[model samples]
Target: MKQNKLIGLGVATMAAFLLLSVNTAEAARTDMVDVSNHNGYMNVSDWTGMRDKYGVKSMVTKISEGTFYKDYTAANNIATAKQAGIYQNGYHFARYKTAAQAESEANYAATLAKQDGLPNNAVLVTDVEAAEQQYTPLTTNDYNNFIFMSTVQKYGYRTDIYTSGSWMNNIMTVKPGTGWIASYPYVVGDKQWYTGNHAWQFSSTQNFAGTTAVGNFDVSQLNDDFYTGGQNTKPVNPVTPPVTNNNQVANQDYAQTGTFTANTTVNVRSGVANNAPIVATYAPGQSLNYNHIYIVNGVVKGRYTSYSGQTRYASMGYIPGGSFGKRSAVSNSRTYTVRYGDSFWSIANRLGINMNSLAAKNGKTINSIIYPNQQLMY
Candidate 1:
């Protein structure tokens, strides 16, 4: 799902015979799989062993991006695929190309799919194959007039479009039967395709055969009311969480002890959420000598104790220019761009610097791999 490769080949063999026959001679369709956080932690017996070994039923997942990341394994992969009963949906890798950045990335993916449970009228997707929407190439009236009408007239959910298949046949405007596409034909039944869109994907590598979820997933084909019809049930569109508690632990507005630093290579965890349990990482200018900090929801964390004594927590990032527990050291001539859940240690903790001085001032190295508009320089 990272940059979803493969494109042309006679327009993907005329988009696989124009779109609909997932092999086995004809009427076969249904499977699905989309995941994010690069497919990690998929319990519930790995979503019932990928739905009893691939019949898969449904699962789009991803959840948020653009209006500044938010998919720390999207609330436990949408509650472990609803306790293995499957049928999940909620995507948003898009980094918007306007209409007020698609209404603030559709209110940050319908408020992280109503704070990651993604149920009421499921289907949220709009991944639009980013490269910043193939460099502002969003047409089809920017996905049917402003990103699926701002996630269905202000978040009632149920929108689609996952792109590619030559950007849904040459950059957007996609509206026929509707959007999912991807295309990878080396042999998805060797011919007879078709697409008014309901879904295609045709393999990023699919290995449901390795059962308990070993790796190669991305598969798709779907259609039969792709996740139960009636235009996906629409009704519950309330959306509010900019933070009532969000990522919890927010009552300390006071705390004392300072001297933090680890602005880039972070993860000390064992607690402050994002699936905890790291217990130590530190690096980029490391230092972390806290005694207690906390603010959380607005981000700051800190705690510190371990040497095996155990307390842990470290993430003294996000204060922007100093003061919450004192970070302000930056300036190697600050400049960063790489967005959409960036990394190189999150642009060296958002430019406070030192992930090897922002990977040697952008010649790149803390294991590189930056994207979305890429620019980095610190």
Candidate 2:
């Protein structure tokens, strides 16, 4: 009896020590990643396994790049994330030529957010960097940054800026509602770059297996002090996409008037698995036509582009009422302002109007180059 008791006490002591060690290790971690495609392309189906395998708690995927690009992998990744019951948000790669251009990009990105089912609560981050032109001067150039984020905010989406500290202080005058700092090689447990209002990017180009992500992706995490359980500024007025589209899509019996925006920039896989090879990518705010979104267990799922490339699926609240389940209807007589990539042809197709009638009504030549902010009646 004495021997058994002594042995039991020894085991208990060892177990306690091990538990303390584990806790200590956890305590030593100061930064975590808000995962994105910058590290590699992540598939939607891969999220759960990636989350469980890598212990990802919060993340935002790459949705748009500049005024024209969209990430194809966003729909599946976002939808699957909702199904997995995780906090998933989105970010946009900004390339603005002017303040007006900035606002246009923001509006376009917000539309993508709505299409992909990103609610007002999901933080929409603008990735400011030199896309069209490298080395944007601090003076004169930075105001566009504010325009980009402010417009996104104006549209009722929670907005953040992902830029360097020097850029935040020197390049841009007005700071974002949330500042996602990019300070690589952070020391474990040392959050010197962390401000009470900012998240830090500790590393880039890190090799993380199992995600099937391509390229060197960035790893960032929100400051524990400022993290709102990964919630963004909710919109005062949320606009939801229609549940059905007028066009009849091929192969699928049903038609949805609604389209989804790409919340993250990832590669579209051939299968609904992460291990599947990357077949394609989507640009930000690039619209996927009616009835192309996938749904599983009431959560919106993205279809393979090969099977259906034109549309992406949006997400509802993983927590319920994330976007208020509100849908925005297309106005037939409404006027749409032309922006960077606007053409009468594209506009008419987007609005389901006749191109010839639209051009004749607007007195525009078919080959005319429409400038940014130019309004046209469809």
Instruction: Report the number of the highest-lDDT candidate.
Output: 1
Candidate 1 C-alpha lDDT tens digits along 216-243? 6676766546554433322111111122
lDDT of residue 84 for candidate 2: 58
| Candidate number of the best TM-score | 2
Q: How big is the positional error of residue 135 in model 1, measured in Å on the Cα after superposition?
A: 15
Q: Across residues 1-378, which tens digit of lDDT does each residue of candidate 2 receive?
A: 100111111111101111111112221121234444433445543455334334344567777777777766566667767775557678887778777888888898888887777656677887764533235566656677777777888767777776665456666543544677665433334334555446766555333333333444455555552334544422221222212223322222223344344443434544433334446665544443233333322223344222222333333211111221322333435566676876777777766567888888888778777788988875
Model 2 CA lDDT for position 68:
78
Pairs in steric clash, model 1 = 16-193, 17-193, 17-194, 18-194, 18-195, 19-193, 19-194, 19-195, 20-193, 140-173
lDDT of 2 at 122: 73
TM-score of each: 0.25, 0.47
Q: All models: lDDT?
A: 0.60, 0.51
Rate residue 50 of model 1 by lDDT.
57
**What lDDT is reached at residue 192 by model 1?**
32
